[model samples]
Structures are given as structure tokens and as C-alpha cells.
Target chain A: MAAANENITADAIEATEFMELSRKYRVTGVPKTIVNETIEIMGGLPEKMFVRQALEMPEE
Target chain B: MGLLSPQDEATLKNHLSGITIPVQLVLFTQAFGGSESGDVAKQILNEVASLNDKITVVEKNFVLDTEDKAKYKIDKAPAIVILSDGTDTRMRMYGAPTGYEFVGLVEAIIVAGTAVIDLDPETMKWLQAVDKPTHIQVFSTPT
Candidate 1:
């Protein structure tokens, strides 16, 4: 997503290395995606689903 | 004493062979008061860069290089900024790129180097339509 759009900035953070950040985002599991600090995705979803959630787009 | 095994290096080199443009991995690390992961990250980056001529690893001090830190918006140590032909890709990896993170790093490099995004067409449409500043942070363990 970040690659396709200039407006998006994506960070892949090592949860174990950054304990404070993991705790702040309440990331107990792996692959926890937080978009804009508002949208929280607990686990990996399908590509389309993940994109929709990240963008806060309505499901079709 | 490279991090990647012989077989892995061969496989990775084959994968990186398709890259047509330069990919600069700008790494930020604080030598003092930093965790051992900084060294690990450097090793991994160098190992990966060794396989591809177009890929280069550029080191930066997190504390001393304040201008670059600010330019890249790096707030932590052991951060990697991916650049495609001197342009910021806005793709960052924090902490050591090991295990699953390693796969992601390679994918990001491929995207940056090839200018090819493998996302679905519909997904690409949505991504291209985004007009606001979207900050996405994905938290994951190395294992």
C-alpha cells in the first residue's frame, strides 16, 4: 500500500524489540496492524480486507 | 560468517536479480545506549546487499545525524529507510529484520527496486486513491 501511494507511510516494527510501542498499541499477538492509531487489526487478513480496513473503506 | 546460509544466498540472489533500479537501504543506529539488534540489523542488511549490485546499505547515526533522522522521521534506533533511486519509498522497518520481518524486507526491496507492486488491481485502486497522510504501523515479533 505504501509503495503504491505516496500519501501512505508504512512501518514494520519488531514487536519484541520495541516493547513500549507494542504495549502502547496493546499488541499481544504477531502481525498486529495499527492504522492511523485508530484502526486496529489483530491478525493478518486477506489483502483486500486488510487494505479496506487500513483505508477505513466501506465493504462492498 | 554471513547470516544467510549458502542456499539462502543463492535463492535470494535469484529473487533480487530482477531489480532494474538502485535500492538504497538507509539504516539508522545509535552506537551507544543501543541494543545488540543494531549490529544484527547491519549484518543482515550487508548480507542481503552483497547478493545484488543494485542494492546498497548506507549507515547513519541516529543521534549524530539529526538532519537525516528528522528527514526520515526516525524516532527509534535500528530503523531502516528504503529508498528507490534516491527517492523515499515511505517504507520503514524498525528493529532487526529477521525471521518473518526478513521476508517483508525482501518484498519491500523488490517493490522499491522494480517499481512493481503485486497487490490486487482493486487494492491498487484504493491505495492510489488515498489522498491523506496515512501512517501504518505493523507490529510483529521476529519469530
Candidate 2:
């Protein structure tokens, strides 16, 4: 997504390596994504579904 | 010892053969008071760079390079900033790129090297339509 738009910046962080951040974000499981520091995705979903949820778009 | 096997190197080299433009991986690592992952990250990046001529690794001191740290808005040690043809891709990796993290790094590199995002058209549209600044942080374990 970051490549698609200049306004988007994506960071892939290792949960184990950044324990403080992981705890701060309440990452209890692997593959947890936090967008804008609010929206939380628990697990990996389909590509479209993941993108929609990450962007906070309404489901169609 | 190198991390990649001979077959892996050949395959990775072939995969990276499509890269026509230069991709620079700017790595920030603290010399002191840093985790051992910094060394791991450096070694991994060097291994990847060795496979492709168009790829280069640029090292930065996380403590000393204050300007660069601020420029990339890096708040932690062992951060990787990917640049495509001297332009910021806004894609970053934190911690050592090992296990599954290495796969993510390779994919990011392909995106940077090819300038192509292999997303669904609809997804691409949505992503391109993003006007506001969006910061996405994905947290995952090595396994």
C-alpha cells in the first residue's frame, strides 16, 4: 500500500524484537496489524478484506 | 557463513534479474546499547545485496545519524528504509529480517525494484485513493 501512495507508510515490525511496542499495542498474537494506532486486526484475512479493514472502509 | 544456500542464491538472483533500477536499502543500527539483531539484520541485508547488482546497502548509525533518523522518522534501532531509485518507498522493516520476515523483505524489495504492486485492481484503486497520511504498522512474530 505504501508503494501505491506516497501518503501511505508501512512498517513491518517483529513482535518479539519490539516487546514494548507489542505490549503497548496489545499484540497478543502474531500477525496483528495496527493502523493509525487505533484499528486492530487480529489475524490475517483475505487481501481485499484486510485492505478494507485496514483502511476502515465499509464492507460491500 | 552465508545464510543462503547456493541454490537459494541462484534463485534469488534470477528473481532479482528483472530489476532495472537501483534499490538502496538504508539500514540504521546502533553501535552500542543495541540488540544483536542489528548484526543479524546487517548480515541478512549483505547476503541479499550480494545476489543482485542493482541492490546496495547503506549503513547508518542509529545514535550518531540524528538527521537521518529524523528524516526517516525512525524511533528504534535496527530499522530498514527502502528507497527505489533514490526515492523513498515509505516501506520499512524493524528488527532482523529472518524467517518469515525475510519473505516480507524480499517482497518489499521486488516492489521497490520493479515499481509494480501486484495487488488487486480494486485494492489498488482504494490504496491510490488514500489522500490522507496513513501509517500502517504490522506486528508479527518470526514463526
Candidate 3:
């Protein structure tokens, strides 16, 4: 997504290695996703679902 | 000792062979009071960089390179900032790229080197329509 749009930045962080960031974001599970610090998605979802949630678009 | 098996290295090299443009991996690591994963991350990046002539690894001191750290807006140690032909791809990976994380790193590199995003048509439309600044952080553990 970051590559698709220049306005977007994506970061993949290892929970165990970056404990401070994990704690700050309250990440207790693996594959937890935080979008703009406003949206918290737990676990992995399908491509469409993940993209929709990341973009804050209403379900279609 | 090398981390990747011989077969895996061959496969990874094959995957990286199609890159047309240069891909730069800027790594930030703290030499002192940092986790051992910094070394692991460096090794992983070095291994990947060794596969493709177009790929290069640039190391930086997380503590001493304050200017570069701030320029990249990196607040964490053992971070990877991916660049495509000297341009920021806005993709970052923290901690060692192992397990599934390794796959993600390779995919990101491909995107950077090719400037091609392999998203679904509808997803591409949505992503391209994003006018506002979006910051995405994905948290996972090596398993």
C-alpha cells in the first residue's frame, strides 16, 4: 500500500524484538495491525478486508 | 555460519534476479545496549544483498547517526528503511527479517526495485485514491 501511494508509509515490526513499541501499541497478539494509530486490527484477514480497514472504508 | 540453507539461498536469489533498478537497504543498529537481533538483521540483509548485484546494504549507527535517524524518522534500533534507486519507498522493517518476516522483506524489495505493486485491481484503485497521509504498522513475532 505504501508503494501504491506516496502518502502512505508502512512499517513491519517484530513484536518480540521491539518490546517497547509492542507495549506502546498494546500488541498482545501476532499479526496485529495498527493503521494511523486509530485502527487496530487483530490477526490477518483477506486482502480486501485488510485494505478496506487500513483505508477506513465502510464495508461494501 | 550462514543462516539460510543452500537451497533457500538459491531460491531467494532466483526471486531477486528480475530487479531492474537498484534497491538500497538502509539499516539502523545500535552497537551498545541493543538486542542481539541487530546482528541477526545485519546478517539477513547482507545475505539478501549478496544475491543481487542491484541490491546494496547501507549500515548506520542508531546512536551516533542522529541526523540520519531523524531524517528517516526512526526512533527504534535495528530498523530497516528500504529505498528504490535513491528514493524512499516508505517501507520499514524492524527487527531481524526471519521466518515470514523474511518473505515480507523480499516482497518489499521487489516492489521497490520494480515500482510495481501487485495488488488486486480494486485494491489498487482504493490505494491509489488515498489522498491523505496513512501510516501503517504491522506487528508480528518470528515463529
Candidate 4:
């Protein structure tokens, strides 16, 4: 997604390495994604579903 | 000792053969008060760079290179910023790129090296339509 848009910046952080960040974001499990510090994805979803939720798009 | 086996090197070379543009991996690692994963990340990046002529690793000191750290907006000890032909890809990886993260690093490299994004067309459309700044942080464990 970051590659697709210049205004987007994506960071892949290791939960164990960044303990403070993990705790701050309430990352209780692996593969948790936080978008814009608000949208939280608990687990890995399908590609389209993940993208939609990350972008806050309405489901079709 | 190198991390990749001989067969793995050959396979990786073939996989990276399609790269036409140069991909620069700007890695930041703190020499002091940093985790051992910093060294591990460096080793993994070096092994990956060895596989493709178009790939290069540019190391930076996380403590000393203040300007670079700010430029890349890297607040952590170890981070990787992928650039495609001198352009920022806005893709970053924190921590050691081992285990499943290694696969992601390879995929990001391919995207950077080829200037291609293999997203679905619909997803691409949605992404391209994004007019505001979007910050995405994905957290994962090594296992």
C-alpha cells in the first residue's frame, strides 16, 4: 500500500523487538496491524478484506 | 559463516534475475547499546545483496548518523529503508529480517528492484485514490 501511494509510509515492526510500541498499541498477538494509530486489525485477513479495513472502506 | 546455503543462493539469484533497476537497502544499526538483532539484520541484508548484482546494502550508524536517521524517520536501532533506483519506496522493515520476515524482505526487494507492485487491480485503485497521509505499522513476531 505504501508503494502504491507516495503519501503512505508502511513500517513492519517486530513485536518482540519493539516492546514499548507493541504495548502502546495493545498488540496482544502476532500479526496485529495498526493503521494511522487507530484502525486495529487483530489477525491476517484476506488481501482484499485487509486492504479495505486498513483503508477504512465500506464493505461491499 | 554465511546464512544462505549454496542451493538457496542459486535459487535467490534466479529469483532476482528479473531486476533491471538498482535497489538500495539503507540499513541503520546502532553499534552500542543496541540489540544483537542489529547484527543479525546486517548479516541477512549482506547475504541477500550477495545474490543480486543490482542490489546493494548501504549501512548507517543509528547513533552517529543523526541526519540520515531523521531523513529516513527511523527512531529505532535497526531499520531498513528500501529505495528503488534512488527513489523512496516508503517501505520499511524494523528488527532482524529472519524467519518469516525474510520472505517479506525478499518480496519488498523484488517490488523495489522491479518497480512493480503485485497488488490486485482493485486494491491498487483504492490505494492510488488515497490523497491523505497514511501511516501503516504492522507488528509481527519472528515465529
Candidate 5:
């Protein structure tokens, strides 16, 4: 996503390496995604679903 | 010891063969008071760099290289900032790129080097429509 758009930045953070961040974000599970510091995705979704949620688009 | 097997190297090399643009991996690591994973990350990046001539790994001091640390906005001990043709891809990886993380690292590198996004056309449109600053942080474990 970040590569596709200059306004977007993506960080793949290791939960175990940064326990403080993991705890701050309440990342109890793996593959937790935080977008714009507001949207929280719990697990991996399909490509379209993940993109929709990450971009906060309205469901069709 | 190399983590990737001989077969893996050949396969990865083939995967990276289409890279036309140069990809630079800037790795920030602290020498002291840092976890062993920093060393592990370094090793993994080095191994990956060895596979493709178009790929280069640049190491930086996490504490001493304050300017670069701020430039990349790296807050962790070991972080990788991917660059395509010396331009920031806005892609970062924290911790050692092993296990599933290794696969993600390779994918990101491909994106940086090949300028190819495997997303659907509609998905690409959505991504291109993004105008506001979107910060995406994905947290995952090695396993």
C-alpha cells in the first residue's frame, strides 16, 4: 500500500521485538494491523477485504 | 550459518532476477544494549543482498546515527527501511526477517526493485486514491 501511494507509509513491526508498542496497540494476536492510528484489523483478510479495511472504505 | 538453504537461494535469485531498479536496504542496529535479533537481522539482510547485485545493504548505528534514525523514523533496535532507486518506499521492517517475516521482506524488496504491485485493478485504484497521510503499522510474531 505504501509503495502504491506516497501518502501512505507501512511498517511491519515484530510484536516480540517491540513489546512496548505491541502492548500499547493491544496486539494480543499476530498479524494485527493498525491504520492511521484508528482502524484496527485483528487478523489477515483476503486482499480486497484487507485493502478495504485498511483504506477505511465503505462496504459494498 | 546461513539460514536459507542452497535450493532457497537459487529460487530467491530467480525471483529477484527481474529487478531493473536498484533497491537499497538501510538497516539500523545498536551495537550495545540491543537484542541478539539485531545481529540476526543483519545476517539475514546480508544473505539477501548476496543473492542480487542490484540489492545493497547499508548499515547505520541506531544510537549514534541520530540523523539517519530520525530520517527513517526508526524507533527500534533493528529496522529495515526499503528504498527503490534511492527513494523511500515508505516500507519498514522491524526485527529479524526470519520465518514468515522473511517472505514479507522478499515481497517488499520485489516491490521496491520491480515497480510491480500484484494488487487487483480496483485495489490499485483505491490505493492511488489515498490522499491523506496513512500510517500503517502491522504487528506480527516470527512464528
Candidate 6:
């Protein structure tokens, strides 16, 4: 998503390495995605479904 | 002794052969009072770069390179900023790129080098239509 748009910046963070961030976001599991610090995705989902949830798009 | 075995190198080299443009991996690491993973990150990046001629690793001091740190908005050590032909891709990886993180790094490099995002057409449309600033942070363990 970051590659497709100039306004998007994506960061892949190590949960164990960055304990503070993980704690701040309450990440107890792997593959936790936080978008704009507002939307939280707990685990991996299908590509289209993940993108939809991440973008907050209405489901069709 | 390198972390990647000879066979692994060969496989990675073959995978990286698809890149047509230069891919620069700008790595920031602190020299003192930093985690050992920083050194590991550097070594991993060097090994990855050694496989592909078009890929180069540029090292930066996390403490000393204040300008670059601010420019990339990097707030931590061992952060990797991916650049495609000298242009920022806005893709970053924090901590050591090992295990599954390595795969993600490779994918990001491919996207940056080729300017091709491997997403569904509809997904691409949604991403391209994004108008506001979006900051995405994905957290995962190395294992």
C-alpha cells in the first residue's frame, strides 16, 4: 500500500525488539497491524480483506 | 562465516535477478549503547547486497546522522529505509530482517526496484485512491 501511494508510509516493526511500542499498542500476538494508530488488526487476513479493513472501506 | 548458506545465497541471487533498477537500503544503527541486533541487521543487509549487483547498503549512524534520522522520520535504531533509484519508497523495516522479516524485506525491495505492487487489481485501486496520509505499522516477532 505504501508503494502504491505517496501519502502512505509503512513500517514493519519487530514485536520483540521494540518492546515499548508493542506494549503501547498492546500487541500480545504476532502480525498485529496498526493503521494510523486508530485501527487495529490482530492477525493476518486475506489480501483483499486486509486491505479493505486497513483502509476502512465499506464491505461490498 | 555468513548467516546464509551457499545454497541460500544462490537462491536469493536468483530471486533478486528480476530487479532492473538500483535498490538502495539505507540502514541506521547506533554504535554505542545499542542492541546487538543492530550489528546483526548490518551483516544481514551486507549479505543480501552481496547477492545482487543492483542492491547496495548504505550505513548511517543513528545517533550522529540527525539530519537523515529526521528526514526519514526514524525514531529507532536498526531501521531500514528502502529507496528505489535514489527515491524514497516510504517503506521501512525496524529491527533485524531475519526469519519472516527477511521475506518481507525482499518483497519490499522488489516492489521498489520494479515499481510494481503485487496486489489484486481491486486492492490496488483502493490503495491508489487513498488521499490522506496513512501510516501503517505492522508488528511481528522474528520467529
Prediction RMSDs, each to the true structure = 0.5, 0.7, 0.9, 0.8, 0.8, 0.6
Residue A25 error, candidate 4, Å:
0.7
Each prediction's DockQ? 0.96, 0.94, 0.92, 0.91, 0.93, 0.94
lDDT of 1 at A9: 99
**Chain A TM-score vs. truth, each candidate:** 0.95, 0.96, 0.94, 0.95, 0.96, 0.95
Residue lDDT tens for model 5, A1-60 = 899999999999989889999999999998999998899999999999999999889999
CAPRI level of candidate 2: high
Query: Which candidate gets the maximum DockQ versus the true structure?
Result: 1
Model 3 earns a TM-score of: 0.98
Residue-by-residue lDDT tens digits, candidate 5, B7-100:
9999999999999999999999999998999899999999999999999999999999999999888888799999999999999999998888
lDDT of 3 by residue, B1-143 (tens): 89999999999999988899999999999999988999999999999999999999999999999999999999998999999999999999999999989999999999999888888999999999999899999999888
lDDT scores for all predictions?
A: 0.96, 0.95, 0.94, 0.93, 0.94, 0.94
Cα error of candidate 3 at position A9, Å: 0.5
Reference contacts recovered by each candidate, as fractions? 0.99, 0.93, 0.93, 0.88, 0.92, 0.94
**After best superposition, candidate 6 residue B130: deviation in angstroms?**
0.3
State chain A's TM-score for model 6: 0.95
Model 4 regions lying over 4 Å from their true place: none
Instruction: Give candidate 5's fnat, 2 decimals.
Output: 0.92
Per-residue lDDT value at A16 in model 6: 94
Pick by lDDT: 4 or 5, better one: 5
Candidate 3 lDDT at B21 equals 93
DockQ for model 3 equals 0.92
lDDT of 1 at A10: 98
Q: List the lowest-lDDT window of 10 residues for candidate 5 chain B.
A: B70-79
Per-candidate TM equals: 0.99, 0.98, 0.98, 0.98, 0.98, 0.99
Docking category of candidate 1: high
Q: By DockQ thresholds, what CAPRI class is model 6?
A: high
